[model samples]
Target: MRSETTPARPLGLTFRLDEVPAEGRRFEGALTEQSLGADLPGMVGDLGYRPTGPARIAGNVYRSAKTELVVDGRVTVGVGFDCVRCLADRVLAVDIREDHVLVRRKARVVEEGEESQTIDDEALEEPDVETFSGEEIDLTDLFRQDLLLALPMNPSCDDVGADDCRDLVGERAPDEPQIDPRWAPLLEMKKKMT
Candidate 1:
């Protein structure tokens, strides 16, 4: 093993700063759930979805400033989720065009107030701002985050009456209420008033 002074190597979906070309660099790659680490796969978060295909990222990474790299790209992935109406397995094709994703130094991001470094509820006042150390930039988490954001709040196979979702879910018979016989008269009277 190397000495304590030696810096650890960047792993997984990371790009060392030295790899960038003078003009710019075009990055094209796929991010899998495994490569993204423990954060992905199976039921996750409130959305309760998982990736069914690789997250494809194609973009141009240009060093706009010494402390910043400007990235423009799109992310496409197929996500598997249970249909809200029928609970059937369904896939959603997610496509997000990221006009700009910044890979800035940690200090630079903090100065701009785009994000907070701490995880405490009080401290998390803003959304994430992708930051990289001086040596390398890792786009793995960014890809995963974008994928999750693209998912719809209510996911289902039905769109415009597909699979009779409205008829099945919306028009179903209401459960019979088991009230005391003594309250039956009041309930009927209440129903009549409505």
Candidate 2:
């Protein structure tokens, strides 16, 4: 009987950042027990099994006239992913400490010889890149992207198959011959000539 225990689920909280309107307002909370939705599931494709883990997200948000939301903080996340090489389910972790600025709508200003541009304005209209919901920001997509970014395109988990895998990538094995599809017509012509 194999019994596995996943980490405790964190709590979920939701609040509007804009609700507390201030030049420099700071909001912080702990995600103790939470559940990730089916859309942004776990590392494994299996829908029946849920990817459970503990995460701590702390950030300071400042709302400026020009900037709707400016968040700066570190999101520590630990997750489990399948090893590409051995196909073994392994525990992988990532810490994303990033600063993101979201503008709801750019303030229009009159300037000499300046055509009103909507560059930053466009980004403001869009959803929050780091955290979408006003209250609790789900770290599922962010966590998954970070895990894949940390992984190599082809990771070698063993030394025995390292050479073989490298050779396969370089295509230098003697047993393996490179076949050119363009020569099919030439081979047919040569057969008729013979």
Top model number, lDDT: 1
Candidate 2 TM-score, C-alpha based: 0.44
Supply every candidate's count of residue pairs whose N, Cα or C atoms clash at under 3 angstroms: 0, 8
Candidate 2, run of 10 with poorest lDDT: 42-51
How well does each candidate superpose onto the true structure, as a TM-score? 0.59, 0.44
What lDDT would candidate 2 get against the real structure?
A: 0.42
Q: Model-by-model lDDT, in order?
A: 0.57, 0.42
Poorest stretch of ten by lDDT in candidate 1: 118-127
Please tell me which predicted candidate would have the highest TM-score against the true structure.
1
Clash pairs detected, candidate 1: none
- Summarize candidate 1's per-residue lDDT along 68-105 as a digit string, tens digits: 66666678877776565555677777778774535444
